[model samples]
Target: MTPIFRRLLLVVFACGLPLMAVRAADPAPPPPAFQEGKEYGKLTTPMPPMVAGKPEVIEFFSYNCPHCHDLEPTAQEWLKRKPNDVQFIRVPVSFNPSWEVTSRAYYVAESLGVLEKMHRPLFEAIHRDKRSLASEDEVAALFVENGVDEAAFRKAYKSFQTETQMRRANQLVQRYGVRGVPMLVVNGQYDVRSPRMFEVVDFLLAR
Candidate 1:
């Protein structure tokens, strides 16, 4: 090889070595810390805790909401790691008649003791399968197909207990002033707005 060409190759390699070393030594940027009005917001008036002596975290969501469907997996992961002292609750928001139908269906699943089995599938049924759960018959059929007794499903769907839970859910929605689905309210005082919702909730729980 020519002397000039060999020298040039060595010079380039020498320069690249330090550059690569610097890149390898650089630390990753830290995650964003929770901030008021950005990561989360303080409620105008904090609501009373649903579970006494335990911090409460409520997720306001709608079954028909595509965003809520998207967040289900991440939420489930967070639930698995969340503090046992914290009481986590899911409140289905009914912004309209159709959503109210789904909200009632949620309570029916809860009442029939099928929520653990039905939750993810229900989200999939609406969002993944693109099926219609907009009516009582459709909701009942889905539950029955998933191993619930058809008679019991219908009974709970119309029973006073489910109706009471639905009313309470609506009350919490109004009190929280929730206008969007997939919202996380921490300790009834902070409404988490950031995409890194669980991190903010962890911060609030620590505080």
Candidate 2:
């Protein structure tokens, strides 16, 4: 074969082979199961926690919300395996005046250093046991039963710090534009709302 002719034939064969391979190749894999703005959303104004250098995972919840109660177990389990760099914060939202009492109760427990002991039990008391813990007195009684001093519980429930935290939580809800309970905010930027909430958070963290 002439040199020029052989060169042109080889080039044509190489180009044709690629086209054939392309035709035989499998289809592209389906898109990811999670879709931005559908399963989750970006916060226009991210309310990242003041904790420096750590990615924040905030759970916007309300004690009165049954969905939050349902999510408590799943959240606790996810915490066991969460990345070390991520700091999880649970913000009790006050949707209205009626919810303010429960919001206060959460911070109160936190202030008295009883949150670790009282968190899940409070959920069980209200949800599983069908107890009406909607008022300050009712909530305080539950705390007292949990071994916290009744007076200390009452003082903390109405303390300046607890009130401030409640106000800040409400402001954050408005800032994050969180419309519902049991919503997970990853690094204060991404709003995740799915049963696979922690999965989405882990994906964001990895990214």
Candidate 3:
């Protein structure tokens, strides 16, 4: 090759180095047999103590995150189609100020035992209505607008138990290394995103 052609080839080779390394790296292996790992069996995490003997699949979601909002329908569908042994949970991130308010709102709803009613509204309020359900007054107003009694909302919103649950959720975020919202963790054993998600679920389920 000519000297000019040799230099051009060197440039191309340098640019391709990262791609070669990426190809060299081993891809994640296929999903394992179900009932084989703790992530698949007798699911229990210390924080909040989700139901044991029942497998858990978690969607680490954040209200301020548009992607998470988009995943809502898929998550709801999964919840509907989930097996009897699988218990689904949504954990809202609390590491940032913008996300903290939404996390608190989730706890408030859980305390009221009205998750079924408020879950969609909360997401719609922030993502669709452009409302910020931040303060007690705002959350209380949201509750009133959604047919929940205002007084009841306030009572549960600031209750000690509700706050504790919120804190516990924060702990879970750290434990799970949940860097991104809308990430899926199956039975706390594996975190899945994109291509490998459902494949891993099926792999574990077959066992």
Q: For all the candidates, what are their Cα RMSDs to the real structure?
A: 11.3, 3.0, 15.1
Worst 10 residues of 3 by lDDT: 34-43
Q: Which one is best on TM-score? A: 2
Q: Give the TM-score of each candidate.
A: 0.83, 0.85, 0.71
For candidate 3, write residues 1-207 as lDDT tens digits: 899988877887878763234555788897644333432333344333278766777778877788878878866666676687777777888767767777877888887888889888888888899997666677678878888988887787778987888888888888777677777776566666553444456565444
lDDT winner between 1 and 2, please give it.
1
- Report the lDDT tens digits of candidate 2 across residue range 18-76: 42345557889998767787777787876656597788888889878899988787888
Candidate 2, superposed: residue stretches over 4 Å from native: 6-30, 47-49
Model 3 residue runs over 4 Å out of place are: 1-50, 195-203
Error of 2 at 168 (Å): 1.0
Q: On residues 93-134, what C-alpha lDDT tens digit does candidate 1 reach at each position?
A: 999998988899889888878899889888999999999999
User: What TM-score number comes out for model 3?
Assistant: 0.71
Report every candidate's CA lDDT: 0.90, 0.83, 0.72
lDDT of 3 at 200: 57
Ranked candidates (lDDT, high to low): 1, 2, 3
Q: What is the lDDT of candidate 2?
A: 0.83
RMSD of 1: 11.3
lDDT, residue 120, candidate 3: 88
